[model samples]
Target: MSKEGRNANGIETLAAETLQRVMEHPATQNDIATVETQLGRYPRGMVAVGARCVGDGTPLVVITGPVLPGGIPFPTTMYLTSPEAVKAVSHLEADGLMRQYNEMLADDTNLRAQYERAHAAYLAFRHGLAERLNESEEHIEGISAGGMPVRVKCLHALVAQSLVMGPGVNPIGDMALERMRNEFDPTVCRCVRAQSDGQETR
Candidate 1:
């Protein structure tokens, strides 16, 4: 779709377009270096670096290609690569927050509707990505990350999507981030040096 046409589809479409343009661009040497240093290895099928640190503008999350090796369709579009963020999310997950979020989704109708919309938007974006990349969308069609549109599963995936797509895109992600404010605050710079080596995360 043309950029102008996508703009007319509303915020979700605009976010998809922004992500599409990022996906089309090749990963720069600097991007590769920082991500590799942060991850301790080379990242595969990395389409674009999405959200960055508010303090330093360093890349935190990334949008990955729909398909990877062995003809596998990757369901998680946005990946949280930041160790600090990952740690924070892990803590939340360990706290059994997914069960609580799932209960919330079951109890509230409006929240469920919003989550369903998020699922649709996520699928639309991924399908567009598949078309742009010349990959088959059959396996991942209608599939979105974090058990969206039904239940809460992975806060990390949801949070990554929320961070990349901006606020109001993923309700569960927004809620999870809100709950874990003390553990992780994107506004502050948490990019510390890796304990194994002296290299900075970003």
Candidate 2:
């Protein structure tokens, strides 16, 4: 089907357009180096910087290809790379927030519908990325990260999606992010590297 037809069919054309822009620009060597430090390993199949920190403008989320270089299937598209963000989200998970989110999803009909939409958008975005890369999407078809459309499994994945797609894309992610504002604020540069660099410059 044509791109327009696919958009009309409820595929997130806006996300596809954003993916195109990201592909056109690509990530810099500095971005890769920083992400390596943040993740403690080289990120595989990284496409571009999906989102940046509001304060220091460092890479916050990465957009990865649907398949790795070795032809391994990777369904996760938006990956959170910042250590502070990861730690904050991990704290939330440790606090049993996922159980609360699952309960909310069970009771709130509107929230469930919103989460379902988020899942569909995630799938569309992953398929769009795969198509752009000319990679096969068969292995990860219908699979979205964050246990979407049914339950809240991972706040890290959900928050990554929210950061990349912006607010309102993932309701549970938005909620998680809101709750973690006291712990981690994206608008503030709480990155360990950023703090270390500040100390050295002083």
Candidate 3:
């Protein structure tokens, strides 16, 4: 994969082809089971475990298909499933981080361009999912999460995108993840009790 671009946070973005390869990996049964435990329910249209909590090595983010079961057009393809991660990101949101990010987008031309690329990368990932699942892109075309290409609506969505696509792919996502690292390091295992029934398989 070639280095295509860099965000304000110094995170290098992957080329569209590289992003596709990274997000197209298949999910294992154990990965799905752990995610189910995290969400307390079955995950629909999940294609891969995009990111894991280093604390417990459990799945924290999942790459879901554009269209889930029952013909539902799922817009947020990268879903955050970890309880800790969700809570941490929610805290950032509650602190007015979205407004801050949007202000950055408005003031920084470089960041806005990088964010636009992030949107493109997200669409490419979704198209890859559509190809693998034999689904059409008609419903999900041009739709990317976290207000990509224009705004930053949700840090959770942005962080999920960064986790799946990697750092520079989503500047805002990278920023969110960076902020939450101190409170919730995904590298450390923290789900010992949560995974005791079957043990951590991620």
Output the number of the lDDT-best candidate: 2
Look at candidate 2 and give me any clashing residue pairs: none
Model 3, residue 170: distance off in Å is: 0.9
Off by over 4 Å in 2: 1-11, 194-202
Give lDDT tens digits, candidate 1, residues 88-153: 999999999999999999999989977877777777777777777788877777788889879888
User: Clashes in each model (backbone N, CA, C under 3 Å)?
Assistant: 0, 0, 12
- What local lDDT score does residue 194 receive in model 1, on the 0 to 100 scale? 51
Instruction: Please provide, for model 3 over 1-202, each residue's C-alpha lDDT reduced to its tens digit, 9 standing for 90 to 100.
Output: 2345333123323434544564556788888887888788888888887777655567888878788889988879888888788988999999999999999999999999889888887776776667867887788689888788899988888888887777767899888888878776666655544653744454
Per-residue lDDT tens digits of candidate 2, residues 20-101? 7667768888888788778878999998998888888789899898889999999888999887899999999999999999
Inter-residue clash pairs, candidate 1: none
Number of the candidate with higher TM-score, 2 or 3 = 2
Per-model TM-score on C-alpha atoms: 0.84, 0.88, 0.83
Q: Where does candidate 1 stray beyond 4 Å? A: 1-8, 20-26, 194-202
lDDT of 3: 0.78
Task: Give the poorly placed runs of model 3, Cα more than 4 Å off.
Answer: 1-25, 195-202
**Residue 180 error, candidate 1, Å:** 1.8
